[model samples]
Target: MFDWLQHIADWLVYDVFNLSTEQHLANALNFFIYDTVKILILLFVIIFFMGIVNSYFPVDKVKNYLSRHKLYGLEYLMASLFGVVTPFCSCSSVPLFIGFVRGGIPLGVTFAFLITSPLVNEVAIGLFIGLFGLKTTLIYIVSGILLGTISGVILQHLKLERYLTPWVKDVLAQAQREQHLFEAEQLAFKQRLPIIWAEVKKILKGVIPYVVLGIAVGGLMHGYIPEGFFEKYMSKDNLFAVPVATILSVPMYSNASGILPVVQVLVSKGIPLGTAIAFMMGVVGLSLPEAMLLKKVMSLKLIAVFFGIVTLCIIISGYVFNVIL
Candidate 1:
């Protein structure tokens, strides 16, 4: 189906361009071209469909339903499950988080959605199933859900509502007053198409730069870095490997699909499965970009607490996987 893309990539790198296939620079550039194209295609298609689905669930109704439910556990679970289908990265999910807050959903429930959205995307799940088989994929998905749910429950118990930026409360208050003013009509298919396109464009503009930069770094590491480095530091025998991997992943930003190629390399090079998976989760679950976007709505203290809880859970999950798998 994408034979033309493959041919164009090959021609650009090796035939028309006359670059040597064996050179490190050529290989890196080729990988960059190929992966960038494929990922962008996936991103556009996924975002468009997600936009269409979201159009059906108006913010006011979502807020009304979620807010009315006092069952914290069920609410968290529902949020996490919704996160799986939406499959947005943390930065991109920020807008959705704002909407959730505007709808008057509990802070903890919003956190659950934010926490799971990036980690449990459909693309990541599909890729994992292809690479590691169903059993391991199930393990990863279940662990992600549990992590989001538990962390959310803890944060809820902390009662950190005041930690939201004042602007969020102001917006929520405004939204509340406006809720009774107009009932949202179901969007016609034609109307939904424009909304989907707009969403795709907006998300692409925000995410492409991060995706490109991340791929460049990963490409360099893939082509230039020696495999022995990971073997020495992240091997199963290294007691600190899990925590170390988790810590290292926090600053780097990449989607799960974007980072899986690097994770595959790490695992193949004798890095423990648990450590490699931890690193991937760290990138997907938390990053500097996500933090920056979140700063618009969350105080520094709340952000710190959120990351701390998530980090602890990921570390524990890594250890458990290492022991069992």
Candidate 2:
């Protein structure tokens, strides 16, 4: 399957178009533009619909009901599902985390939402589905949710609640007052278009730079990175490769959409699927930016612990996949 896809991609780039270096660069730029546009469109559409749902649905009531339940498994499932639907980035997630904590949700459960929301977002999922097959995409999504839930539960059990910043606790106290407020006059769907567009513009402004950077890195890897490099260091036969890849990817941040092409190159060149997937997961979910953002609400100890746990989980996942497939 991978070989077939690679053949097609190769044909598209080299045979049909006969692209030169300049043309390859142009193609790279075109890919960046295409990816950015697609992500922006998906973000706007999903968030706009989320806004409409927020306006009409009784979220508070639902949250209140869910908060009464103490089943950690169920809570994790719900939190993961919530993540799939919420249109939030890592930075934006702090506010929602604050709200969840203030609303009396367990810290572990909140973490589940925080981790999965940005890492396994709809736009990322859509891109993965398009680039990889359905099986790999589904596995990625399920793994993200499961990781979030298990991590959350483990944190809760560790009693790390004391590691939260004092300010975070204080902020949680105001959750009751931070209710959503909509205009008294309800706007029709047609009227909502402009409002949604403005919100979309705001989101695009924040994401465009990161998207560009991700694409630039991807383009370089696609066109110039040596196939032998991956084979030597990241091959399935290399026992240390999984952990090494996981560690190396932690400081970087890029979603599957941006990384899939790079993963394709790696897999084509003999990198292990598990190692590559683990690297991608680490990059997407346990990034430097996420750690910095989390610092605002957590102590150094908490952040270190969170990172350690997720990194361990990713390594295990990689090894597991390696053994199974």
TM-score of each: 0.68, 0.63
lDDT of all predictions, in order shown?
0.74, 0.65
The segments of candidate 2 whose C-alpha lies over 4 angstroms from its true place after superposition are: 1-68, 87-89, 174-232
Scored against the true structure, residue 117 in model 1 reaches a CA lDDT of: 91
lDDT of 1 by residue, 3-104 (tens): 688678888999877889877777767766765676567667655654554455445667578557667488888888899998676665666676566556
lDDT score, candidate 2 = 0.65
- Number of clashes in model 1? 0
In model 2, the Cα lDDT at residue 306 comes to 87
Q: Taking the tens digit of each residue's C-alpha lDDT, what string does model 2 give over 1-325?
A: 1244445545666566677645656455444444444444554555455445544543465466766765648887789779877755543454466446544567888888877776687778887777767888888788888888888888878889899987656543322222233334555666656654564455446445644565455445444444234335677677899988888776454555566677777777778788888887776677665565566568999989988888898898888777765
So what's the TM-score on candidate 2?
A: 0.63
Top lDDT hit:
1
